[model samples]
Target: MSMMKTILAAVAGAATALALAAAPAQAAPTAPHVRGTSTVPAYSYENAIRESVWVQTTLDGDLDGVPDKVAVDLVRPRETAAAHQRVPVVMEASPYYACCGRGNEGELKEYDANGTIAKEPLFYDNYFVPRGYAFVAVDLPGTNRSTGCEDVGGRNEVLGAKAVVDWLNGRARATYADGSAAVATRWTNGKVGMIGKSWDGSIANGVAATGVEGLETIVPIAGISSWYDYTRFNGVIRSPGYATFLSEYVSSRPEACTANLAELATGSGDDTGDLNAFWAERNYRPKASRVKASVFVVHGVNDTNVTTSQFAHWWSALRTPKKIWLAQQGHVDPFDFRRAAWVETLHRWFDFYLQGLRNGIDRAPQASVETAPGTWVDQRTWPAAGTRPVRVGLGNGDGVTGTLGGSSGNAKRTWTDNPDLFEAEATATPNTPVPGRVAFLSAPLRRDLRLSGIPTATLKVKVDRPTTELTARLVDYGTAARVNYQGPEEGITTLGTESCWGSSTAADDACYLDTAEDVVTDDHAVLTRGWQDAAHHVSLRFRTPLTPGRWYTIDVPLQATDQIVRTGHVLGLILQQSDNEYSTPSTMGATLSLDLAGSSLTLPVASGSLPPAGATAPQVKTAPAPATSSLRRPDLRQLP
Candidate 1:
C-alpha cells in the first residue's frame, strides 16, 4: 500500500510541472514612467519597429475611380508588434515630405531599399519613440507616395489625414503595399496627438477642429487657421493664384492635378479677393466648438509668411484646455529657437495627455511669451492678465507728422498713395515730413508700455479714387537690440557644431546643427502691420467702392503683437498705401484725406498708460538702421 501511494504522488507532481511549463511567460510592463518630472526611456529606441501602410480615404481628389490612399510611415517600440503592448501616436501629415522638406535644415524624408522610412525629418520621431510613443509621419494626399491630387487645405487634404487617425482607432481601413490589410487594432490604444510646423501644422489644426474621437491633442506651430486670411487681407490679394501655386509646388505629380489646380484658381476669387464658399470650407476657426482635443499653440509674433493673425483668431475661438508659446521669431520652428526647453515642455505635455500621467503640466501657466530678444516669461493667459483696450485720438498737426494723444483735434491731413514705396521707407523719420504717407507720434512714454494684443485703426477718410489700397503700421521708435525677424534667416543662425536629441541608426542620426538667436540693434521696429482695400472697407465678402470726396469710416485690423515700448521710446502710427511687399500695387495714385477728430487707434495695452500730449519727443542718436531687405516670401519649392 505504501509503494502504490508513492508512485501516484510522483506521477501527479510530474503532471503539475508539465502544465506550468506549457503556460506563457508573464508580459513585461511596457508603460513608461515619470522620473523627476520627465518620462524615463523604458523602451529601446534603436530596436524600435518601423513599417509603412497606405490608409484609404473617401475622397477621389485625382478624379481616379478608387478612393485616395495616404502613405503612412510608422515607428514604434518593438513591444507593440505582437499585440503585447499598446501605445499612443504622435502624427505629422505633411505635403513637404518629398518636396520642400521641413525644419530649418529643410530635411526631406529618406527611405531604405525595402521602401521603409530610413530617415525621418526633424527630432519628433527620434525623441518620442523611445519614450514609449509611436511616431507616425504621413504623406498628404498627392504628395510623396500617397495616391491623389493635392488640394491645399480642402476636404481631400483634411479628410485624407483624418483617415489615418481613424484607422488606428479601428474606424477606417488601411493596407500594406502588397495588397494585405494593415490593421492597427493590435498596436494602438486609440489615442493620438497631431503636431507639425507650417503647412503640416495647418493640417493638424484642421484635423483637431473635426473633433475626431481618437485624437487627444494637437501642437500647431505657426499654422494657418483660415486659408482666406492666409492669402488675402481684408479683400486684398497678397499673392494671385496662391492656392493653385502652392498646390502645384507640393504635388509630386503636378500634371495629374490639373483639374484640381484650375478649380483652386477659379474658387480663390483672386479677381475680387472676396470671401466665398471656397474659403469658408477651408476655414477652421468657425469649427472650434467641435474640437475635443487639448491645444498647444505656438507662433512667431513677427511671422510674415503665415502672419500672427492665424494664431490670434484660432486661440480666441478654442474652448478646450489650451496653452500657447509666443516666440520672437519669424516663420521658424521653436525646436530650432528654443530646443532644450521645447523638447522638455513638449515631453511633459505628451506624457500628461497621451500617457495619462499626472505630471501637473495641465495646472501650470498657460502662456510663454518672449518679451524681449531671447527672453521668455510665463503668464496665466495670453494677451496678458490685465489687458484693456485704450483709444488714442489721431491729432492733425503738420500734414507730415501728426499728434497722437488722449483728446481729439479737429484738423485734416492729406497724403497721396505711392504704389512703389516700401514700408521701411514710408515709416522712416516719424517726427519729420515724408511724402506719400502721414505719421502720428505719441508723446515719449513715461513708463514701459506693453501692447499685448491686436490693434485696430479706425479712420474717417475721403479718397480721390473709387478704390485704393491702405496700409497701417504700428512702429516702436527706440534704439535697442531686437530679434532680427526680417533677416533672411528669420532670427536664427545655424552653427557648425551638432547636438543629438535621442538614439540614432546608421541611416538616420538623432543630431542637428546648433543655432543662436540673430539679434540686430536698430533705431525702430515695426511691431504690427495691417492691409486693406478702401473699396472693401464695408465687408470682406462684398466691395462697395468708395465715393470720391465722401467721408467713410473704415477699421483696419492690425496683426497681433506682444511688445514692450520701453520708457523714453516714442510710439508712432504710420498710414500709407499699397505695401508692394504684402499686396499687389493698386498704382491708382489716389489721395486720402483724413478727419483727425474722427480717427483713432485702439490698442490692447497690458501695462502703463499713454503719456499726455506736448511731451517733447527726445532725439536719440540713431545707429545705422539694420539693413532693410525686400520681404521675400519663402519659396515652397526650395525652402532652404
Candidate 2:
C-alpha cells in the first residue's frame, strides 16, 4: 500500500507539470451547442440529422386567462429524402421557467469561485443526432425569451411540447447537413422521442403524460419521480440542491442568458409563483392508463442529488414497455464519454421503439452497467420470476436478521443518529465517508447468490424525535471486501413539514437563489418541475442489486455522516442519514430505530453449497441453530 501511494503521488506530480507546460497553447474552439462535438459535422442530414433554432407560441388550455410563449433548438434528419422513417428526438425542457429566455454560451465557470457559468457541461455536438435521430431543447413558458408565466408543473410546458411537435411536423427545411437543398416540412416521419439529463429529465416524464400524437419514447436520467419526497427525504426538509439550481442559480443569470429569470422573479411566492403547481400543472407518468410512450429510465446509483429510489416508482407503475438503465456514475456523468458507445445504446433503444428496428436492444436485460460484477442478466421480466417479499429484523448496533417465509419471531435493534457525520465532506473516489448507517455480516457464502433487480427493507422504526430521516442501502458482501453494486438508495421522510425554498440578496453570494427574497439553498426551497414523491411509513424497495461476497446492511437508525470514515478496507454496508458536502444539504439532530425482526436482506440463492471462508463464490451451506434472525445458509437451493 505504501509503495502504491508513493507511485501515485509521483504520477500526479508529473501530470501536473505536463499540464502547466501545455497551458499557454490555445486550443481550437469547439462548436457552441449542447452536446457539441468536434469530430463530426454539426448537422448531418445524410445520416439523418440537422440542427436549427425554432420558435412557437403557447396556448391557454386551462383558460388561465393569460397566454404564453415558447422557443426551441430543433435538430433532426432531412425530411424529403427519408419518408416513413421514424426517429427518436431528445429534448431538454429548461430547468427554470425563466431558463429559455436567454441562452447560455456553454461557459465553463470556476469550480468554487473562479467564475464559470454553472451550465450543464456539453459532452459532444449533436453526437446523438448523427447517430441517426432528432433532438430538441426548448425554453419553458415565460422563460428565456419565451412567453407565459412560469407555469411550472402545470399543463403549459406539456402543451408547449405539443406545439413544438406540430411546428416540426408542418415545417419545410431549406437544406440538409450535406449542404443539399430540401424542404423543411418534408422531414416528418411522424415519431418523436424525448431524453434529457437532470431537470430536463423531469420534464421528459412530465410531457410524456400529455400523450402527444408523435411521442414514442422517453429517457429520464437522475431526475426525481416525486416532488414531495424529492425535496424532503425521511420527513426532513433537505437542501434543495436541484431547486437551488433553477430558482436561485439560474434566476441570478443575465436576462439575455435565460429570459424567464425576470418573470420568475416577478411572480408572487404564495400562489402566483410558477415554480409551484399553482401556475403550471405537475407532470407525472400517466396513471398507468394515459401513458403512450415507451419509457427507458436511467439514474446514477450513487447520485447524491437525486436518490436512486426516484426512478423505482415510475419503473413499477409505467404502462408502456419500459427498460431502466442504472449507471454507477453521477448525474449526467454518462455523457462524459465522447465516443458513441454509451450514446449508441441510447439510440438503439429509441430505434427499436420508434422505428420498429428489429435490433437486440429490446431484448437486452432490464438493467445493465459496464463496470458491475458480472455480464448482464437477461430475464423474461424484472423483480425476477416467482420471488416473494422477505422481511428482516435489524439488531442493535449493526446486527441484522429476519425471516422470508418461515415463522421467525419478532426482534428489535437500537441506534444513535450521530449528527457529526454531517460535517465530513465527500469526494467522488474509491475511499470516502459511508455515513450514519450500520453494518451486519453473514458468514461466508456457500453458493453463488445471483440477486438481480431490486431489494428493499420494511422496518417499524422510531426516531428520537417526531421527525427523522432514514436511508436504506443494500450491498452484496464480495470477496476481498468488494461490495457488489446495489441499486440507488431510498431516502424516506415526512411531508409538508419538509424544507421550502428561501433566498435573499443579502445572503451569502454562494447561496443558490430562487428569488431576491426567497432562496432555495441546500436548505429550504422546493420546485415541482414534476417527478414522483414518497410519503412516510412507506416500505420502499430499491431497484439495484447486491453481489456475492459483499455484506448487505440496512441503516434504519439512520443518522448523518458529514465527515469521511476511512476505516481499513473491508466490504461494507454503508449507511447514511444526512447528505453532507458529498450529498444534498441536510439538517442535523435525530435518533432512529429499526425493528430487526421485520427487516432482512434477500439473495437469489443458486443451487450449490457454501464455499470455504476465503473462496470468492462459496458453494456450500450448513444448517445452524436459529439463534438470531440473521442466518448463514451453507447449501444452495436446488433449481425447481
Candidate 3:
C-alpha cells in the first residue's frame, strides 16, 4: 500500500476515537505510551474518557528553557521487529487557529475540546503509524498545550519544528494503539521530511528554508509563498474570501481573537497597497529563495480559494531543486488519485536526496499533468520555451463560416456598452454563465500545432462607462478527434469547490466550464468592476498546454451588468450581456480594439519526440491544409 493510504488510515483511526468521545461527561482516553525517562512529569489525561491527547516532554528541547509540555500522541507500531527498523519521520504544523494562529499564545487544546480525532480528520490512525512514518503534528508555539505566544509570521514555528526534529532523532519513544513501539529513538536515522496541505504546506516550506539539520524533503500542496497574492491578487482584494478566512481564525484565537466579530468582520487586515516590511515578513518569498531541500509542488489550476497565482509565484521564485505537479483540478486534488502518484514520486525524491538511494528521481518527469491531456509531460525545465507564439483576430458575420482572406473581411468588430447594464457590479456576472464574452481563435493548424507556452490576450478597449472589468480564458477545442476540457470541470467538483459534475463524453449540455457562479473570491484580486485600469489591459494567464488535433478556444468575458438576458453555449466571436459577476460588462459607450497582431501566446514545441537532449529543435513541416475551408474569426454578438 502507498504511504498516503497508510497515513490516511492511521489518522482516521485516531479521528474515530475522538468522534466517539463528544459526550459532555465521559473522560477522554489516554493515548498508549511506552515507558521512558521523562525530563518532565508524564502527561496525563482521564483514561476512561472516549478521546484525549496530551503533550509532555520526553527530553528537554531547549537548554535555556524549562521542559515544555508539547502536544503529541504516541501511536505504537504493529510489531517489535518493525520497531527496530529505521522509520521515516513526518512532521507538520496545524492551521492558524485562535490559540494557534500566529502570535497567539495558548496551549493546543483538543479541536473544539471534543477530544475526538475525527473532528481533526487531517490527522487520524489511517495516516502515519501504518506507513512506518512517525507523524508529529505540532501546534506552533502559543497554541494548544505548547508554550509561547503566537507569532503569525515569526520564526517560532520553524524553530519549534527543528526542536522536535532533534528530540525525535534522540531517545524518544512512542506507543501505538496496540502498545508497540511505533517510534523508538533507535528507528530514527537523523532524517525527516514534511508534508502538508495549505497552512501545513506553508509551515513545511518555512521549516525547509531554515535548512534545519536532518531535514530532507518537502511536499507542499496548495501552499502560499507570497502573502500578497493570497490576500490580494494583482493588488486587488479577493475581498471576503481572504478577509473572511482571516476573520474566522482570528475569532478562534482569544488573544488576537480579542476583536469582536464585528471588528474582525471588517475585511482587509491592513489598508496599505504598497509592499512593506510588514507584508514582506508575512510573505514567503524570502523563505522560498532559501529552500535547498528537494520539493514537490502540487496545486490546482482553477483554485480561486488560494488562487493558483501564489503557486506560480513560488514555482518561479524557489531556489531549491524542485518539481511542480499541476492537478488540473482544485485545491483538494492532491488527496485523490494524485495522492498515489505523489507517494511514489515523493518516495523516490526523498530516497534520492535523503537516503542516497538512486531511484531515478533525477530522470523523472518535471512537469506532470496538463488538465485535458491527463498524462505527465517529462521535461528538463518548466515553461519549456519553443512553441511559436500564435496570434489571431476576432471578426463579425453569420453562422456560416467566413474565410480568413475574404474580400468583405472587416478589421474591427464593435459591441455596445449599455450604461443601464454596465456597473461596478458587472464583473461578478461573468463568474457564472453569461450570454458570452469576446473570443479569438487561431487558424486550424496545417501541421500538427504543438504548443506549451504562456498565453496573453490584450484588447485596445475604450468604455463609455467608468466602472467595468473583463475576464479572459484559453480553451482547447477537440477538432479532429475526441478531447476533454471537463478534466478541469470535474476536478474542481472533486475538490469541493463547486457543486457541478461534468460528463466525460463531449456533450454540449453536460460538458462545459462552470460559469454559473463566480468562484473567484474578492480576495483573489483579479480585475474588478469600477477599478478597470485603462492604462493596463486586462488579461488572464496560467501555465497550461494544449494537445494536437484540437481547436483551442480563448474566452474573454466582460462582467458586471444589469440588463439583457443571455444563455446557451455559442462558438465564435460571441458576446452575451448579463448582470452576473462572471458575465460580460454592460455597454455604456465603448469602442474595443482587440489587437490580435500584437498579443501572442507562445508555446514550447518539442523537436525530436524521444526526450529532448538538452534543448534541440523539433522537426517541422509546412504541410498543406487538408482540403479544408479557411478558418474565420467568430463575431462577438452571436454568443451564448
Candidate 4:
C-alpha cells in the first residue's frame, strides 16, 4: 500500500512539471505606442542600444585593391532586440560628422571607450530611438573612420550611401569592427528615411535619386541637386578647385586620397566651366524619374551658398510624392528657424513614411513658403498658384536710370566691367547713375506684386572681350525690415539660453542654444541674381568666344524666388559685369553695350501688373549699410 501511494505522488509531481513547462513564456515588453499621428516614447532612451558597423561598398575610391568600407553608427531602442521587434531607420549620411561638425552649435559625434558611439551630434537619436526607431549616422567614404577617399559628390559618395540602405534591406553586406558579419535583418523593418543639411543633405538627395530600395523618404535642407550648379553658375565657375578643396577638408586621411583629389580638380572642369560626363554623373536632376521615395525639400530663398537654383531645378523635376519649405533665412536648418513646429512636422513626416502610419501628412498642403519674415503660408502648389511669365521691355534712357516698361526705340546703354565694384555699390543709388552698371526702374506698383518662380533676362549685348562675365540682378527698392540673410549671423542669432528637445544623458544632451531671426531694415534688397559667361552663352557644355564688338543675344535665368513687392516700392533691374560675390571677375575695363529695345525681363508674376511706364516713380531713399557682426557664416568656407 505504501509503494502504490508513492507511485501516485511521483506521477502527480511529473504531471505538474509538464503543465508548467507547457505554459508560454511571458511576452516581451510591447513596442512603442502610437497616439494620433506620432510615435510616443514608450521605450527608455538612455538604455537604448548603441553600436557601429562597417558597410562594404562596390567602390575602390581610394585606389585600393578591395572595395571600401563605410562607417555606420547607430542608436536603436533596446525593445527592438528584447521584444524581437523590427524598426525602421532614420539616417543622415554625412561628411561633416567629424570635421566641420553639424547644426547651429557645430556638434560632433562622441564615442565611448568600447569604440561604439556614445553620443550623436543632433537630436535625432535622442528623440526617435525611444519611439521605436533606429537612427543611423553614416560617415561617407573617406570621412571619419570610413575606408576610402572622398570623391566629392561622385559615384563613390553616392554609391557608398546607397550601400547602407541596401544593407538595411538585407541586400548588401556589413561587418563589425572585428570583421565579424553584422546583420540588420533581425532588427530592421527595411524602411529608411534620410535627413540632413548642406553636403549631408546633398548625399541624401543623391541616394534617393538612385531609386534604391527600402528608402521611403528624404528630407534634404539646402541640398545640391547638381554638382555643376554647385560649383558653377551658368558656365561660370564660382570657386576654382572648390571640389578638391572640399574633398580634402572633409577627408580623414588626405594624404591617401591624392589621386582622388587630382581627379576631382581635373574633372570639375573649372578651367572651361563646362558640363561634362564627370558632372553629368553627379547631376541628380536627370535621375529624378527613377526616385521612388518621397522627398521633403527645405531651402533658404536667400541661401547664396547652395543658392535657390539647386532646389528649384530639383523640385521642378520630381514627380514622386514631395513637399517643400522655402525659408526666408540663409543657409540654415529649419530647426534653428522654427524649432517646435519643425520638430512636430518632421515627426509626422517620419511617422508617416518610416512607420507606415496612415496619418494624413501625405494629404497635407504640398508647399509651405515663408512669404515674409516670420510669416509662412501653405499652398496647394509652389510658384503660388496663378504664376505666369510676363515679359517687360527695357526702355532706353540715360546710362543710369531707364524705364522698365514702355515702347522703346533702338537706344543703347553701355557699362564697363569693374572687378573691384561689389554688388552693394553697383545696386545702390538706382535713380542716380552708377559706374560699371546700368539700371532700369519701374513706376511704383499700384498694388502688392507677388513674383514667384524664376525670371529670365533676355539681353542683346556686345562685349569687346572674348569671354566676359554677365550679371543680372532683380532688386527691390524700398525701406522695410527684412531677414538679414547677408548679415554676419545668416538670419538667426544664437542666444545663451538653452532649450531641450528630448531625453538626455551625460554624454548626449538634447539641449541646444536658442535662436531668433536676425532682421534688419534696408532701403534695397537684391531679390535674385544670375551670372553667366559670354563664352558659354550658347550652351553650358561648350564655349563660343565672342568676336570683338560682335552682337549676341543671351538668356540669363535669374535665381528662383518668391517675393512680394509692396505698393509704393519700385522694381528695378540692374545689368552689370563681374558679380564679385559669386563669380570670377571679368577682365578689368571690358566694355559691354546693351540694345535696350531688344532686352526684356521676363517675370513670373503671381499678382498685380506693373504700373504704366508713364506713371510717377517713387522717390528713392539712401539707407545706411546693413549691420554686420562677427557671427560665423554657414557656408563651409570661413568669412574674411
- TM-score of each model, paired residue for residue: 0.92, 0.57, 0.55, 0.93
lDDT of 4 by residue, 67-100 (tens): 9999999998887689788999999999988997
lDDT of 4 at 417: 81
- Residue 247 of model 2, lDDT score: 45
Tens-place lDDT per residue, model 1, 1-640, is: 9999999999999999999999998975544434655667766777888889999999899896889999999999885565477888999999999988888788999988889888888888888888778999999999999998878788888999999999999999999889899989788898999999988889999999889999999999999899888988888888776888888878997877888888998999888888899999899999999999999999999998889999999999999999999999998999889999999999999999998888899999999999898899999999899999999988654544677774445678888876756677766776665577888888888999999999999988898888888889999988889999989889998999999998888877889999999999888999999988888888888889888989998898999999999998889898987777677744468998888898899999999988886633334334332244654433322221
Best candidate, lDDT: 4
Model 3, 41-80: lDDT tens digits are 1211111112223333433322225543344433323342
Quote the positional error of residue 515 for candidate 4 in Å: 0.7
RMSD of each: 6.2, 21.6, 18.6, 7.3
Candidate 1: residue 607 Cα off by (Å): 0.4
Worst 10 residues of 4 by lDDT: 631-640
TM-score of 1: 0.92
Task: lDDT for model 3, please.
Answer: 0.41
Superposing every Cα of model 3 onto the true structure, what RMSD results? 18.6
lDDT of 2 at 561: 11
TM-score for candidate 4: 0.93
> Model 3 — which ten-residue stretch has the worst lDDT?
560-569
What local lDDT score does residue 212 receive in model 2, on the 0 to 100 scale?
Answer: 65
